[model samples]
Structures are given as structure tokens and as C-alpha cells.
Target chain A: MSGISLSTTSYRNVSIVLFTLLVVTLVLAELHLGPLAWVAALVIACAKTVLVAVYFMHLRFATPLTRVFALAGVVWYVILLGLTLGDVLTRAH
Target chain B: MTHLAIAPQFDDAAQQHESAALGMWAFLATEVLFFGGLLTVYTVYRMAHPAAFAEASSHLYTWIGAVNTVVLLLSSWTMALAVHAGAHGERARIIRMLAATMALGLAFLLLKAVEYYLDFHDHLVPGRAFRPDWSTNAPAAQMFFILYFILTGMHAAHMLVGVLVVACFVAVIRTTPSPARHANALELVGLYWHFVDIVWIFLFPLLYLVA
Candidate 1:
């Protein structure tokens, strides 16, 4: 069997977990906790992204090099958002 | 076990699969940057006009966005299952799962079409016809709708392409002699599909839940 292959049962388990997290995030959105709501939504979104990438996309079973390559995109994206936001948020009114 | 015919460039099936997987990941890495650029722009504008963005977000059909998220997630799950079946050389199961995935993809597009229709009816298209019902900051609210259309339109375009590719793949696999040999190909397609799903995973919150 290939390293990337997971059993049917495992896929079902992951899907259930993903659905549950989706519900939680939706509930959080409905709570309207100001900035905390946004933070919670984004945090849960990241968690859901990791779950899909790791299990559905089979990154967990991928080779170390593949994993690094995958992480590279996300890391670069963070830098892009981070630096831009840093400049924008800190600019004088 | 059925023997896999190794390509001239590859020493074995495993090597071929890994090379293909690596190449797909490389493509996906570029895709990440592609969508990331738009998201960064959205964040910058959103931070600049938080009130406008929030008001515009409130006008969206949150229920439709929520349902579509579930649809895309379900499609990703089905795509993953199809890849799993492909690894086992279960041709029938692979076809079934791919069909289910494709069906879900179409369903998402359909829902998106409904949302777009409603958005148009509400004058949310961000041009001369753009008339936001908000009492304050109409111009900034228009910017929010501009980003809204661009981001969701780009995402819907990806979904359309995915549905087409999966449809063609299903047709080809149905006639192929050994579908298991195409497992790597299936996995690559699944990666693309799942990456698109992940994009929506972020988009839903950023676009719909802002209020």
C-alpha cells in the first residue's frame, strides 16, 4: 500500500471531526464576540485547513520533502500578510 | 499483484508516483500564492474599512454561504475516498466516488448561481448598478462588494474547472484497462480539488461572517 493511502474508516473519522469543527466555527460566528469572534473564526479556519491538508490531501503520509514544500506556500503567505498588515496597521493617522 | 508499467524516466511505480506527487505539490504551492495575494488585498482593505466591510458582509446570505461550505467539504471528502479506492484498484468504487464528488461540485455551483442571482437582484455588483442599502459609507461598502465578487467569482471559476476535469477523468477511467495505474493521477487531482476547498474554507469566514 502507498504511504498516502488511508483506510475508509479513517477517512470517515476525519470527515466527522471536520464537520464538528465546522459547526463550532459557525456557532462562534453567531456569538458575535467582537474582535474575538474574528479571531476565533480565523483560528478555527486554520485548524480546518490543517485537517484537510493533512488527511484529505494526504500531507501527513507525504514524504518530509513534500511536507516542507507544502509548508513553504503557507509560510510565505503568512509573511506576505504579516508584513503588509504590520505596515498598514502601524501607519500614523 | 498487477504489475505497473514503469515509464522510461522512472525506475519503478513508487518513483513515478512520488515525482508526480511532488510536481503536483509544487503546482499547489504556486496556487497557494495565487489565492494568497487576493486574500492579502482583502485583508488590507478590510482593515482600512472595517465598518464598511462589516456592513457589507451583513447583507450577504450567510445561510447560502454556510450550506455551500458544507457542500464543498462533503465533495472533498468524496474526492478523498475516490483516491483511496483508486489505490486499492477498485475501479467501480473509484468511479462511484468521483461521480459523487462531481455531483457535489455541481450542487455547489448551483447554489452559488442562486447566490449570485440574489446578489444581482440586490444591486451588489459594484458598478453603476451598485446601490448598497447601508446608511453610511456607501463607497467603502462598494469596495467590500468588489472584493466579494472577485474572490467568490474566482473561487467559482475554480469549481467550474474542477467539475470539468473530474467529469473528463471519470469518462477516461471508465474506459481505461487498468484504473489502478492512474492512482497517482487521481491523487494529484484530489490535491487540486482539496486545495480549492481549503480556499473556500477561509473565504467563507472572511466574506460572509465578518459582521
Candidate 2:
């Protein structure tokens, strides 16, 4: 919970909370939400992704090289989205 | 014995752990790009045929997808625990958690198999000869199904790989002499497993959340 070095007890504790959130978010996103479902879904998904990265992937205590590589994918993905959406959204006949 | 003997380049336990973690991250980054290509196709098609995209997306089995998401989320938690056990040099705990994660992953695959069976039976599979009573826009709908199968199918393949990887980790735990040397294996496999879950995180919304 506190740092890069994760303990099994910590993992188990975090698992319970994260999983409960996963279920709750899925139910809420599926049932009541309509157009805004994706927003909720993305937020929950981001939370889960961060948890896995920081804990299981060891990115919390990873070296500078590792962090750079991890962030590179994210930065590149964002750039991909920006460029693609820019092309699609900004284009006109 | 060979695995227990020593890795050539790694000097100490910490170096081995760092290298393995970093190596797995690099592999996952490439995986991100691999999935990125398919996601690009999805974005383009969704843009081109918004109505049909919405229609096709509406036909997905939302409950099944949601359940599988929960399953994977739980499995990832187990995976994180397995890594924790490894870091603490608790070999038995590592084995137990790894096995649990692998079983959950297999359960996810079985559920996905059922979903595909329904797809085929429903004629939801994309093809020129396809027939569906749900919508007249069969072509676009078929394309969506195609993308769905390809994307999720590829993901399932990755899950299978994760399962095998976890199984291997279990075996290593049984046979490897220096458990300390191989603690990094747990972290490496955990990295891959988490990446698989993260992909599904995005997939759940893309496939099932359309209104």
C-alpha cells in the first residue's frame, strides 16, 4: 500500500477492495448509465490498470528505464489517439 | 538445475529481479502496440458506420462479458499476491496463489468459449453467408462481430499463454533450487498477467457499454 515492495497481506487486502469496486462499477455502468457508461467504465478500468501496474508489475519500485518504457506506451497511445481523432474530427470536405 | 545455477548477466538477486521486471514491461509495451493496431481499426470502423457499430455492439452478451471482467480482476489480485509471496520468499504461498490465478484464468476461457458457442449458434459470426433475425444491417454487424472475435479471440489466446506461464511458474517452484534467484519469475509472469487484465478492462467497455 505504501511503496514498491508489496506484501502478500497487502495484496490480499487491496484485492478485496479493488474487486469489490470492479463489480460495483460494472453493475452500475451496465444498468443505469447510458451514454455516460463509458466514462464510468474508463475510470474504473484506469483504477484497476494502475493497481496492477503498481503492484503486480512492480512499476512502483521499478528503475527509471522501466518507468520510461511503461510511460512510453501510454504517451504513444495518447499520441495515437490525438493524431487519429484529430484527423477524423478535424477533417472536412 | 540449469535455471537454478545462474543467469549469465545478472550479478545479484536484485539485478535479476530488475531485469526480469523490466524485460516483461518491454514485452508488454509491444503487446500494447499489437492491440493498438486492432483498436485503431475499431475506431476507424466505428467512425465510418456509427449506426451499424452501435447496432452490432448492442448484441454482445453483456452479463457474460461483465462476469469475465470480474473473474480476470480477481485473478489479477491473486497474481499480485503470488508476486508478493515470491518477494517474501514464501514458496508455498506463491505456488498456491499462482495456481489459483491459473484456475481463474481457465474459468474465464471456459466462459468465453461458451460466449463464442452462442455467437456461432446465433449466426452472429461475421461472414458473407451470415443470417441474423436481429438486424437488417447484417454486413456491418458482421464486421463488428469479426472485430469482436478477432480482438477477444486474440485476448483469449493471451490468457491461455498466461495460464501456461503460471503453470510453468508453479513447476519452477517445485524444481528450482534457488527460489531466491527465481523470485523474479513471479514478477515477470505477474506483469504479463496484469497486462492481459488491463486489455480486458478496455475491452469490456468497448464491447458491452454501447447504448
Candidate 3:
């Protein structure tokens, strides 16, 4: 917790291992699963994305401002998806 | 404590690193907005015609999509290693990892080309050649293919730019000794690469799975 601590080993280890687990889960879901396949895939995809950001991109080690920048994108994702779909879905057309 | 060729405007190397990182993050945030617009259109259309979109999505090859996902993941890991190596001033390791990342990026592009060819040959390419199932609302399904080509095409273009940027970053490190202080720029580029990976991560599920 001093000058620019870089936990490369731990981060990289988790990333590679998670990559394997993610692929296995993906293939299995593709093989089975009914209407839930898409849901499973989306969840897995989000997990993979988080691992890349926190570990691979080293955002876990980044400063608070940097983390804020990253989270802002997600905020936009919510607003964009929520607003556009909310308006369209609620209206009776 | 090494002398860094920091820009005159920057007070010190650490300040420079922070500024660069923040600037890159700001740019990435804008990219989210850029891509978000397309996603909104995509969602609206899909919401309006769920079954047709699902039908169009089924035509995609999930196995190939999985292959590309793994390829990009490996590239991202290598890119991460390159950033780590850069931090320690391990020049050779940096080169090796960056080269490996570049190689994987090229592999992803090649596989994508093959997939596109298959799409075209299967009559799945949007425009005139698009041959949707006759039973489905062919026009609405065509909309899916239209969005597919646009989304994936833009993503591929970003990957191409990333590959070039990594190549140049490698060349820069090779030419410059003690790239010690500039480690953050490499990390910033790594962030860009990972962001691209995230885009494809979401795209894979949205485009490849239908149920």
C-alpha cells in the first residue's frame, strides 16, 4: 500500500483462470439451456468484462478518478438502454 | 527518480501519468456514448420485433463467436502482461507480450474475415444478398442483419486501429531506452484494448445467442 503497488501476478492469475472458466460455461450453455441461454451468456459476458477491467486493465489498482471514468460508461449504459427501451416498450403502438 | 522527458507543461512524471490516464478515460467515456446510440437503435428494433430478431440471431454461428471471444481474451491478457513488463522496464518481455497480443489480434481479424465470407455465402449478409427465412418477416430480419454488419464492422475497425497502435507502441519502446516513466501510456493503451474486448464481449451474446 505504498508507492504504486502493482499486483501483476495475482491479477494475471485470476484473469487467465477466469478465462478458462468463462469459456467452459459458455460452451455448456450453448449446448443446453432453453430460453435462459441468452441470459446465461449475457451474465457470463458481463463477468468476463469485469475481470478484464479490474484485473487485465488494472483498474483495481487505478486511482479513484480513473475508476469514476470507467463507471461513468456503465451509468450511460443504464440511461441509454433504460430510457430508449422504456419509452418504446411502454407506449401502445 | 530517473529523469523523464516529461512535457514542459507537466510538473513531474507522476502528474503527467495521471493527466494522460484521465484524458484516455475521458475519451473512452465518449466512446461509450458513441456506441450507445447504435445500441439504442438496435434495442428499439429488437424490442419491436423480438421473434424476427431472434430468428436472425440464430443464423449466427455461436461456436465461431466463442472462438473469437477466446482470441480477444488471450490478446487482452497478453496486453496486460505487456503493461506489467513495461512497468518493470522489462523491454524484451514487453516486446514479446506485445507481439503476442498483436499476433492474436491478427488471428481474430482473420477468423472474422472467414466468418464474414461464410455469412455472405450463406446469404446472411444484409442488403440485397440477405435471404431471410421466407416464413419470418423478411424485412424485419433484414433489419437485424443490417445492425449486425454495422455493429461488428465498427468493432472490427476499432480492433484494426488497436492492432496498429500496439505495433507502434512496440516500435517506440524498441527505439527508446528507459521508457520507465512512460509506462502509464502503455497502460492507457492497454485500457483501450480491454475496452474493445468488452465491446466484443457484449456483442457476442447479443448477436450470437437467440432463445
Candidate 4:
């Protein structure tokens, strides 16, 4: 999985690996891991999103402009989280 | 005949494919913001009443949410393969994969229906008739359920659209049957399918696991 594997994965293998990862994380995320459960779940979700974006969406072979457009979602999302959450988290009750 | 597949508006196949992909990403960008707004709301409300949000979240059926997550991710995988086949012009492969993706989407929706039914029975749905074991925090809990239903309902609506889109993609492939020339179609559908999956990727933990 260098630079998204260059479309190297077959569908069956890709599905199986991804499904297994999801199941394992789901089962694990259910336990009482304190705040860690939340953290772990978020991390797993990010990883899963990356897997789908890079592999399933074929961003590996995408042009730089296209990749920029694709990444714009993630980048802009962080901005959304940053600005709004910063305001919310910091404001007085 | 094969050359006519390249629309008159496009000079060549590759450029057409690139343009199509770029357009899809641009669309997905807006979709991200659309869902992002809801999620931002989620964050704000949760921060305001973390305990009540957590309580309401716990009332959610973890099993149902977990299973749905699996279903959607698997569907994305299937769509990936279908797109792979489409890129190479494998008609049978494209049909099979697309069918699998659509069926998985349907299965996800079916499970969602079951969850909604059970939540309603449990009085987890917010309305005048709302009731929950955590009645003391009922107001904040009700707020949680409101966002819950709205977000997941919106998500389910998107999934329904995904199913129909896959169905249409199947029809397109059947008519064109030229893998190399029609590669853009496959790629575009795969992108949309995965975008839906990505949305769930964020929603699952926020709604289900964080509690």
C-alpha cells in the first residue's frame, strides 16, 4: 500500500480485508474503554475513510488537480471542525 | 461506433474521463459540506450536554449500527470491483459487482428500517409521545434523538439514492458495453458510492461508539 497500491488489490481481497478490519474495530469500540473508545473509534473511522478514498475511489491514479479536489473535502472539513468547535469549546457558559 | 462513445463536447476519451472525475469530486466536496453542517451541529450539541448525549447514545442499538456499518463498507468494496471491471470493459464483472453493491445497499436500508422500528417501540424517537428510561434528562436526551434521527435519516435517504444510482449505472453499462470508453461512468459511480460510505464512516462512531 504505497500511495494507495496503484489499483493492485482485487475486489474480493479488498472487501474481505476491509470487512474484517471494520468488524474488529466495531467489536472493540463497544467495550468500556473510557474516552479511549471514542478516540479509537474516531481513529478507525479516519483510517477507513482513507482506505475507501485512496483505493476504492482510485485517487492513486488521479491527477494532481483531481486529488486536490478530493482532498479539499477533508481539508475543508477540518476547517469546519476547527473554527466552529474552537468557538464553541472556548466560549463561556 | 466505439468512437461515438466520446461525446462531441469532449476532444478525447482521457480528457472526458478526467473531466468527469473532476466534476464528481467537485460535487462530493459540496456533499461533504452538506453533511459537515449536520456534524458540526452534532459537535455543538454534544459539547453542551455531554452526559445527556451520552445517555441517549447508549440507548441506541449498537448491534444494529455496527451491522449497518459493515454492510455499507462492503458495498463500497463491491462498487470498487465493479468499477474496476467497468474500467477494463468486463460487462459481466461490472453487472455482477454493481448488483452486489445495490443489494448490499438494500440490505443496509432494511436493517435501518428494523432499527427505526425498534427505536420507535422503545420510544427513542422524539415526539410528543417520547419516553425513555432516562426521563430526568429527557429534554436534552430528546435533543440528542432529534439530531440522531435527522442525521441518520438524511444518511439513509442518501443510501437510497445510491441504490437507484447503481441501478442506473447498470443500465448505462448494458447499453454502452465498452469498458475502456465508458471507464468514466464506472469511476464516477464508484466515487459517489464511496462518498456515501465515507459519510457513514464518520457517523457510526459519533452516534454509536462514543457513548
Candidate 5:
């Protein structure tokens, strides 16, 4: 039961590392990647999001039901994109 | 453990956790639809005027957008830290993180304001008064800029509300005796924060990178 607890130091450390990585990625993206730099930008973003959800949000120790709720949000987003785009693409120009 | 062991226990912590998770998930589903409508509109315009869209986008302050993205990302990081503090029963730490998140959120809104000001000065804003220096497809480009302002402006409004909410939460943490019930509240805010960040992630690529 106690295994779920995260220390403040660890949290700070993680935040530092994530922020540093984000800054570095932004610099690199600006310097060399051009418009396509969004790929690197997004990868860093996904990593940061995961870290927040897992460690900060306590999703790591959350019951399966909570995970289901978060996953449902993602799935719903996809369905929304799919259905809307379907109509958009199929409509006459 | 037998079914009876877990069944019929209104006080069962596990069952409560499950229900909470389910509730949060249901709300997030609605959020998906909310953002989906905007995405659809954005997509339609992009498809309608691909070249104009690209040209219009080039006028944007790319570095400002990049900085805003990082700022929001940092807010999310602090928010996550706040939630972690809540779970660990560290009220002080949670309050600190909440304050940090609010500050970063404010910073993002400030940067956005500056960007908007620049837009206005450059005549990049739409509504019958746009005057792009090097123009192509002025009408379509104007429409694109209009949509950009509305969408990002709405996002900024949300961020403003989010900052207020976080400030209120911090106050609660500081004043009231901490309650376990607030855990879910913290989590809900985290969900909202994450959703905002996700929207921007898509926006950055669509508006700035889709050349």
C-alpha cells in the first residue's frame, strides 16, 4: 500500500529533467529541424504528459477504473476525429 | 477472496476508487467531443485553402507559440506535482505546486497577449481591416487568421479560467483543513490541464508546421 507514495525530491527531480529536455528540444527544433520540428516537439510532449499522468496524477497507482476513464477520453477523441473527418471528406467540394 | 468478501460493502475503498475513475472517464469523453468540433472546423479550412493557409501561418510568431507551449507544458508539470503531493498527503507541497502552476499559466496568457498585440500591429488580424504586407489569397488568408485568433483566443480564455481555478484551489489548501475528497478535485483539474496541453500539441503542428 505504501509503495504508491512518491517523494517530493523525486518529483522535483523529474520536473527539472522534463523541463530541461523541453528547452533543449525547443532549441534543437528551432536551430535545425525547421517546420518538421513538430515531430520532436510532440515526442517530448507525449513524454511529459505521461510523466505527469503517471507520477503527478497518481494514475500509476490508481484503480483500473480510473485508467479506464482516462483511456475513454482518448478513445472518444479518436472517434470524434474519425466521424467528423468522415463527413468532411465525403462532402461535395 | 470470495465475491462476498468484496460485495455489499458501501465503504469498500476499492469500489469507491473504481466509481471515481469511471466518473472521470465519462467527463473526459464529453471533453473530447468539445474539442473535436473545433478540430473539425480547423481541418475544413486547412483543406479548403492549403496554400493560403500555409502563407497565413508563416506570419505567426512561431517562437512565441513555441514559448507558450513550453510554458503550458511547465504548468502541467507543476499540476502533476501538485496531484502527487495530494496523494502523498503533503498539503504544503501541494499548495506550492498549485501556486507554481498558476504562475506559469499566467505567463502563457501574457505571452499570448503579446502575440495578439503583434498580430494587431502587423495588420494580421482579420475582420475587414487586414493588411498583409506580402499578400496572396487575402480573403482566405484573412479567414485563416480570424480562425486562428478565435481558437487561440478561446484557449487563452480557458487558460485564464484555469489559472483562477488553481488559485482558488491553492487557497483552499492553505486555509481549510485538507480533506481526502479534494483528491478527486485535484485530479479533475489535472485532467483539464492535460486536455488543454493536448489541444495545443495538435494546434502547434496544424497551424505552424503544416507546410
Candidate 6:
């Protein structure tokens, strides 16, 4: 019972932190800091994704095999993005 | 120990739970690629036409996007609570939290409908009716709106499906006995819900903060 209550508290804390990060990103967006804004927003977005996956989605408590399976999608995505962007960026247009 | 009616194929409840979770994660992996394809397309185009993309994105209702982000995030929190309650066999709390999650999801879709209505009013919809005056590069700007509609439309469709599933689960729980045994099922649903939220997290910034 105590463990359950403790976890509930942790969930609330995580939510609060997530909300704060959202606000921070929004403020950053409003600033229009050029390319830096894009980098900052994407980075913060990744952070938010990790938080949700790890805590909200219970990936933190997930089995190692499950975690690897979950990460497979992201790894494949990075490969796709990297290869495609590499081609696009390197092309002599 | 025998509360769960484990399927004959599975050796026990623990195996059933782990197998179910693994399967869901595998499906979610494919889902990532599904959305990732569109994202890659968007990234390529945005990189090619940065100015046009930024100008086009600026025309989006940032406030709506921001609020919707909060809505989705809150819904995810409710969903987490629901799954947590399920783990503890708090059936009533599970039901309440799931209901709250569903409500928030529907709220997101409602706001999205409003935003879509406004987009149409503003002639932001891609096609012959699309207004290209927003950016110097008319074609590329139109492309931005096209991606915008596609991404958000797909997201909204996922949310609709999620709401329907949650509703079904709620009904099942209400009508069935020993809702605690459904914890594994609820956890799977919660995983799907959170993945949808994560997609929106990336979309919010990419589509709304492109300036």
C-alpha cells in the first residue's frame, strides 16, 4: 500500500515537471530565436517523449527485452532520417 | 493466484502479461515507422524550403496547438493514473481515471475541429482553394499546409480510435467481474495512449513552432 501511494506521488511529480517543460518550450517558441529555437524545441520535445515513455508508459519498470523492443522503433527511425537527410544535405543542387 | 483466467496457451499469468506487453511494444514499434515516414517527408521538405515552411507554420493557430498539447499531456497523466489504479486493484479509481482520460481526448478532438474550421476559413487547406499569399514561395507554402493537414488529420484519427477503445474497455470493466484481472489489458491500452501522446508532443513543436 505504501509503495502504491509513493508511486502515485511520483506520477504527480512527473506530471508537474512535464507541464513546466511544456511552458518553457512555449515561451521559447514565442521568442523566435531562429534556428536555435528549432534545436531547443526538438530537444525539449525529445525530453518530454522520454519522460512519458519512461514514467507514464512504465518503460522504466519494463523488462530489458521490452525496453530494447521499444527502442528498436526509434533506432530504425534515426537510421531512416539520417540516411535520407544525408542524401538531401550532400546533394549538389 | 487463480483469479486470472489465463489462456490455455500461456503457462501462467506472468507469462501472459509479459507476452502481451512484448506484443504491444512490437506493434508500437511498427507504428513508430508508420508515423516516422511522414515525419521524414516533412523534415526533408522543411530542410529544403526552410523559409517557406517557417512562414507557412506561422499561419497555424499556435494557441490552439499549445492548448491541445496540454490537453494530450493531461490525458496521458490520467491514463497513467488509470493504469496505476488498475495495478492496485482499485477498480473504481481505474474507471474514473479512464473516463477522465477519454474526456480529455474528446476535448482535444473538439479543439482540433475548431482549429480545422478556422483553417478552412483562413483558406489554409491545401488545394486550389489554398491561399498562398502567406509566403513568398507559394508552392512550398502550400506543401507545408498539405503536410500540416496530413499529420494532424492522422493524429486526430488515432485519438478517435483511442477514445473508442477506452470506452469499450470502460464498458467491459463495468459489466464484468474482477476488473483487477484486467490490469494487463489496461496497461496495454495505456501504452497505446501514451504513444499517441508522444507523437503529438513532437508534432506540436514541429508544426507550430516552425518560425
Model number with the top TM-score: 1
- Would candidate 5 be rated incorrect, acceptable, medium or high by CAPRI criteria? acceptable
For model 3, residues B167-196, the per-residue Cα lDDT tens digits are: 999899898867665587788889899899
Superposed Cα deviation of residue B108, candidate 5 (Å): 1.2
lDDT of 2 by residue, B53-75 (tens): 77887778888998898899889
Top DockQ prediction, candidate number: 1
Residue range B1-211, candidate 6, lDDT tens digits: 2256678999877778778889999999999999999999999999999999989888899999999999999999999999888877777898899999999999999999999999999999988888767569999998898899999999999999999999998998887778777888898999999999999999999999998
TM-score-wise, the better of 2 and 5 is: 2
lDDT of 4 by residue, B116-189 (tens): 99999998888877987765688889988999999999999999998998998888777774655666666787
Q: For residues A1-93, could you state the per-residue lDDT of candidate 6 as single tens digits?
A: 112232778889999999999999999988889999999999999999999998887777777898999999999999999999999999999
* Clashes (N, CA, C under 3 Å) per candidate: 0, 0, 0, 1, 1, 0
lDDT minimum window of 10 residues, candidate 4 chain A: A1-10
lDDT of 2 at B161: 91
Candidate 4: residue pairs that collide: B89-B179
The stretch of ten residues in a row with the least summed lDDT in candidate 4 chain B is B1-10
Clashing pairs in 1: none
True contacts kept of 1: 0.67
- In angstroms, the error of model 3 at B167 is 1.1
What ranking of all candidate models by DockQ puts the best one first? 1, 6, 3, 4, 2, 5
Question: Candidate 5's residue-wise lDDT over B1-211, tens digit each?
Answer: 1111233554664565456556766775776667667767877787778778878888888889888877877787788778767655578888888999999999998999999999898989886668976877888888788778877877788788889988888888787564344665676777678667766755765676544
True contacts kept of each: 0.67, 0.59, 0.62, 0.72, 0.38, 0.77
Residue runs of model 4 more than 4 Å from their true location after superposition: A1-10, B1-4, B177-180
- Candidate 6: C-alpha RMSD to true structure equals 2.0
Over B1-211, each residue of candidate 1 has an lDDT whose tens digit, in order, gives: 4345678998877788778878988888898999999999999998888888998899999999999999999999999999888887888999999999999999999999999999999998989988876639998898888889999999999999999999988998899999887888888899999999999999999999997
Model 5 local distance difference test score: 0.73
In model 5, the fraction of reference contacts reproduced equals 0.38
